[model samples]
Target: MGCMQKCEMSLGFESGSVTSDQISCSNQEQYTGWYSSWMPTKARLNNQGFGCAWLSKFNDQYQWIQIDLREVGVVSGILTQGRCDADEWITKYSVQYRTMETLNWIYYKDQTGNNRVFYGNSDRSSTVQNLLRPPIVARYIRLLPLGWHTRIAMRMDLLMCMNKCT
Candidate 1:
């Protein structure tokens, strides 16, 4: 079964920014949480740190984003919140990963039989099973949106990263 670990790097973001490159990490210590904006441009700022950049392309329509972990490592697991937009509902959601050098994202289910699976359809809360693997390093990670009940904006909450085995 995969274990969960906390991200060692800091997450910094700028409010009202339209691009990821504009999200500065200069004062990495000043960042305490994740930042999301509804700008149509893609920008990310990682002055001295190294990590992946992600943003939800379907803003105001669906809450989703994609990450590329540059390198592969043992991914214990992840915990996220179902914070959809006003009057919106998230019927299904999933987490997927792929090698840093590849373009295809290898789903956890197709990789190993031992994986933690969670489902959130009602209260928007769940803890899926744990996939304990040999630190299979990957480059790309994607968050896919399955269903939307309302036409309002889509939001997510408390998206936490777990243990990263190198």
Candidate 2:
């Protein structure tokens, strides 16, 4: 299939809504139905994997789980968020895209490190943002987890895969 010319795709989980039933991993049932029940000690989807698990000190603080969609075509924008907890940890975030298919991930824009990002430690709430850079033909994307005032881990709200519009 040909890539879409102008498309916006988003891929992510639904905050605290992600239960063991939603995640199809071997250890998925360990957490059951509670969002704060388990921390992602190790997670991998598609062909990417996150090696570290989430850790927090306070149950009141918030955290984030994000992905970088290496330009698949033309991305109009992207967004991410957490659920159950309060929106305090995440302040801002940025999406770094590239056209390379290798594992090496280059910065496609300025590092959006905790500035204008939102951290909602909830179970279903989500946040969306527009990509500053135009979409390019890419094959590698990276998800950077940022923000955390406590020791508790953060969950994903949604992961949108914005492909070119057909």
Candidate 3:
């Protein structure tokens, strides 16, 4: 994630190019905001919405926030941060992706073939970055929290691959 930061292009989250409609989460639309007002759209990096970040009711591994790139493309890295107004944040997570809605999701595995557990932020404001070696070419991406501080809360940014034109 060190050098990957300088090379990858942000995939439009911070700039609003990735519209709110393109973002969704598990257990969404299944209920109303009577439990929480934390929308998936508030997960953008540096978001200052009323919620300030995505606050999940279920902290289990089953919960996730997803992004639809709208088409297949290279995803190089991810940037994560905790909730703006609380001490909640993800401490560890894994990634899953696919090129189409009907396709099966695949975990971004480590060199050893195990699902890669990317370390995330420890505090509420600092950003933690994780690079996908051999980056993924997919239209949809999901970040699943394996462990977190207090509970599962996150604000994030996705980095697009910067390939040299040949």
Candidate 4:
């Protein structure tokens, strides 16, 4: 990844629908009130009060949060922040995406099977980012946390460039 120069245009969460694998609070039968924190706004990290989605109880399996852009767009970069209330953060992660109406996911990787490992935030308050070279044109993006110390948690934002400037 190289330095991300600001483009004249940038697309964000406001441009799409976001969802996650975290259990919601709607189904009372399986819902615990504590896990009711999957709202898209929780990823903004503006304040410290439950500012991130606590996916599940430290399950060793991979957990993910995804965004549907509703249409195809070129994703230029990703910004991530850790859970503000806890020291836990995703130390290693990989990204995969799919284009419009496609069920197949394309892993962001090099010629080698190894995918790019994003070094996540070291502290809860700070932010980390990974800028994609030759931006990926896709409508669906998924963040898979591959490494975790305690549990999987993250606040993410996508940067997309839709138009070119002189």
Best by TM-score: 3
- The sequence of per-residue lDDT tens digits that candidate 4 reaches over residues 101-146 is 4478778985576787777777766777788876778877777777
Least accurate stretch of 10 residues (summed lDDT) in model 2? 42-51
Candidate 1, which segments miss by more than 4 Å at Cα? 1-36, 39-64, 110-117, 121-136, 151-166
lDDT of 3 by residue, 1-166 (tens): 2333344899888899999888898887753655356878889898875788988878898999999999898898999999999899999999999999999999999999999999999999998889888889899999999999999999999989755553
Q: Worst lDDT window (10 residues) for model 4?
A: 22-31
lDDT values for all models:
0.37, 0.37, 0.88, 0.63
lDDT of 2 at 78: 43
TM-score for each predicted model, relative to the true structure:
0.43, 0.42, 0.90, 0.75
Per-residue lDDT value at 18 in model 4: 45
Instruction: Determine which window of 10 residues in candidate 3 has minimal summed lDDT.
Output: 1-10
Q: How big is the positional error of residue 45 in model 3, measured in Å on the Cα after superposition?
A: 0.3
Clashing pairs in model 4, backbone N/Cα/C closer than 3 A: none
Query: With candidate 1 superimposed using the best TM-score fit, by how many Å does residue 85's alpha carbon deviate from the native?
Result: 6.2
Deviating ranges (above 4 Å) for candidate 3: 1-7, 34-36, 162-166
For model 2 the TM-score comes to 0.42
Model 2 off-target regions past 4 Å?
1-4, 12-73, 86-88, 98-103, 110-126, 145-166
RMSD of 4: 5.6
lDDT of 1 at 113: 62
Q: lDDT score of model 4?
A: 0.63
